[model samples]
Target chain A: MEGKVDTRYWRFCLWMGPTFVLVFFLCWGVLGHNFPPFPPDTPASEVAGWFRENHNGVKLGMVIAMTFAPAYGVWGYALAKILGQVIRDEHNIIVQLARLGAAWTTMAILIATSFWLTAAFRPDALPDWMIQLLYDMAWLLIDLAYAVTSVQLFALGIGFLADKREVPLIPKWLAWYGIWVGFMFAAECLMPYFMNGAFARNGILNFWIEFLIWMVWVPYLTICGFKAIGRIEQE
Target chain B: MREAVQADLASANSQSATDDTIPPGDSGVWVFIIADMCAFALFFVLFAAGRIAQPEVYEASRQQLDGAIGLANTLILLTSGAFMAQAVRAARKGNRAATLSGLGLALGVGLLFGITKAFEWSAKLNQGIGLTTNEFFTYYFVFTGIHFLHFVVGIGVLFALIARVRKFDLDTTQQRWIESGGAYWHMVDLLWIVLFAMLYLMRAA
Candidate 1:
């Protein structure tokens, strides 16, 4: 198995995970004006007003985000491959499911950001209600489609836990942490029912707690993945 | 040879009895538990802020809640937690019958809490109160709803422990599993106590 593996290409793919994270936080999060997202209860006129003022930035940010979204898919593929090795079953159902989850998660980001882009594309001509509707639609899709990402996290965590090595590649504590992170995403289910307060999309629990932990998990996992690959090569 | 065998048995038992360096379950499980507690702490803070922001609404909503039911649920969880502790202790001592019975009792009592919660939630919905009703109801539903998810997961963990205990006398690793599951169940119970205090017992104003 080691002889057949291309370690260099694998490392390159693994690096894409952080690359995806950096680009996403910069493009979708900062420049897209999503860092402190507008409250869910914002009126249509105000929603339209922001879009009118910042349409160019939104367009740039989301377009960059959509283009680089596939980096996440590549990173997921690398993660699944490493997980296959860790669990010693390339054809494991969990590994395959995680791979599919990565694909779908990427699509979720792409489709949702496209909505934001469209909202900005014709913000001047479109009705204020329509622009607000598009904005709301984008948030609903991005936040509600969290289950796919959760599946990916769970599969990876489970796969790591299944490793029987004397010293597992990923620490058991981190695996448990990953599972906890996956479980926390269930809070996103409350987003639709909340237009304000902590359960809402921009609220503390839903956005700050949920997304911040996720952001931490991704970079943490990426670092661990790099170390795990190095260790496997030594073995 | 027989004396040597007895001495070895005694040594093993003594080590199991006296070893207090490691935690109840293992360090990994404690990590999970601590992280979960931190998340719940954040939720509690957010709830307090919400109350402070709207004292009258929170006070009115708190009045509508049934403190008796909250107390009942708290007692139910406490009882279930005690049974779970018994199961873990029995498993550690190799008392299979006691372990199985204790687990069974715990699971049965835990299910009653769930049934009660279902009824409570249904009653609220019948009264036209829901997640979207107001700030207080929203907090009430979401907090309890998330806690209910934890309860469901705890039940599954208990069932898994029961199956393992029924199948064989636990070895060291299996004993750790029992301890870990027991710790998680206790955490669930502890979270409920705080939730009950905040939502039902405390003066919202």
Candidate 2:
């Protein structure tokens, strides 16, 4: 029989779930206020009104904490810890650190490339301030994913090659799958910028293709991360 | 062996085929972040369309936001993110006291951030600006409000982690908890930095 699931993890989930529901409800509730509340209608005037009317409230803090804490905070840390354990024997801790460093370095380069490319053709399409904002947000996503994935993959690859050990933290197939999926994402990110006019010249494929890929890959990565996290003890 | 590998790959492929609930990469703790981003995307899209429709109101409203508080919050969140990161590293090294201390520092910084935000929101509300006032307040309410909720949850998670971390195996659970927590905290911080520009600084320009 399966043992009892970890309650602390459940508590983390419980705390996270309701707050998520509330955010969605608040967003979709068809509530009033002219700041162009719906997606298609949003504009600078509406957003400015949003800025002008902005007030500090308990709800804001509550939402921020609920949305951010477990997802990136708890889950990300857990992912790191799993990495530390998975490679406990074959490689020293320094190797893990090196993997993390390399991952982040690569991510930074990719982000810089995306920013420079996006800004090159447009000139002032995105203002200096806006450019910086997008740059930071985009990089955060890149770095976080890169750091976590790098360590995990390094561990799996090394373990696979070294002792033929069953990579306890992540299933061998799942780990390989993650690397493949990650590589696809990298290719997708690089393709439009590198391939030039030959493919996706219309730019129509850029948006929809990404949508399709995310539709397939996002869940796969999430499941893999969670399964790996949950298996930490077993490892 | 080949057949087993093929079967595993098949299962993985089939698993990602569905488009219902949350996406696969957004399970467990990340469920909230994914949902939060979607909600924010909706808000952003709304903002974009609204700007297209009524450039005047959006621009005027932009002139009124407090850039100072936005900057302050950015700094606070960034600082808390640093603490959280430190906590994760400390925990991974099996330094229980350091883990607790680091988490405590993060929690304290987070609370300070909430307090400042609360004061900021209350002051704005007192000034007669709120969600019901216009589209701007609506987003102000929705976006900042959502961000605030995330802040609170981050604190709670820190507390929970602090409480139970002592008992768990340092190698497996403790460090991951801290790392994920820090990453989420950093996202919040990062979002605020964006908001600072879009809502506040962008207006000045």
Candidate 3:
């Protein structure tokens, strides 16, 4: 029995890719005050002071971030399904791996945000050291968990590179860029080793360059995903 | 089969003549190389900023580094890059023997670079200097460590090129593969030169 495929729903899923990007940047980045994240070497009292002043904003940001965390998974699913179509192998392991990576990435984001939320939940009652510890723990968990997102990009890149079409669904340069971005995430591994320098969680190399590259990659891939869906529908 | 091989050689030469406008290697590989360079540039900027912030610490750390070893690794990578260039050129000419020899020499020299780097890192580690020793050593270990990763990947690419060239004729696509791998190997060399200069030779003040 042939069942009808809903191309409209697929398009909506692809649209979620950008929606996730916008919401994530606003809530987790700007409102959460993670745009210029607290330095790893920040004193416990300072950490507590900042949280005390911005607890409500932090709480709201983390709540919205956690609620919409699954948007990333939905976006990944849509991208992977389109990738399966491009490779003409619906059961390809790389596609599933990409999907799994996105799911785990969502979990990482969710858990990290929850830690921040809990830190904000009782900033007045908790010790300054406790708040600082929670903050540090959240950053470490999110930064070091970069490999999960790397796996997703690598799988997607490999999948796109394997497409034999003369005009591939995803651009070849974008695929290479994705792989390069994934490789750059290796810098995050050095985050735990340094407290203030370039390799630190808040340093230029680890935080600004790494996250900016990832942010650029998401929109690039989302645009490509939208185009790929349109092309697949036409075919 | 021999005629087919000869045909491929002629095609490669003709393609080579017309493809001058195209940059060496696969454009996709170039994309990766360019992005990787941008990342390393950011690393260098940050290192420079840190050095400026603590010039005395950086200068002291620079003195502690073995400059002779850094210079020697620079030469090794230069030599490896030359061999890689030779390999790509030979592949274009469909000279299988020279291609293999060039690749083999490049891979060997690349391995020597790795060995030298391992010894340098171990020596430092044995001296109780490591990534977290200070801002200077932090930059040192992190920069060199990441460059070491690129070198390792370049070695793997060279090995893969050798295996591919061994089994298949140097068709146009295989030639492109060689060029791409050679491009990446050269990039590794280029990055190390900058790293060597920034870390070992430059006066922090």
Per-candidate TM vs. native? 0.94, 0.43, 0.93
Place model 1 in a CAPRI quality band: medium
What CA RMSD would candidate 1 show? 3.6
Every candidate's chain B TM-score? 0.90, 0.80, 0.91
Tell how far residue B35 is off in model 3, in angstroms.
Answer: 1.1
Cα lDDT tens digits for candidate 3, A59-82: 999999899999999989988898
Two-chain DockQ for each candidate model: 0.76, 0.02, 0.73
- Candidate 2 local lDDT, A44-63, one digit each (tens): 34433332343122224323
* Candidate number with greatest DockQ: 1
Ranking the candidates on lDDT from highest down gives: 3, 1, 2
lDDT of 2 by residue, B79-169 (tens): 8888877776666556778878888888898888888888888988898887656666656665677677667767887888888776676
Tens digits of lDDT, candidate 3, B1-205: 9999877766766454345588767788889999999888988887888888888999999999999999999999999999988888888888999999999999998899989999999999999998888888987888898899999889999899999999999888888899889889989999998999999998754
lDDT of 1 at A123: 94
The Cα error of candidate 1 at residue B137, in Å, is 1.8
* Docking quality level of the chain pair in candidate 2: incorrect
Least accurate 10 contiguous residues by lDDT in model 3 chain A: A1-10
Pick the winner on lDDT between candidates 2 and 3: 3
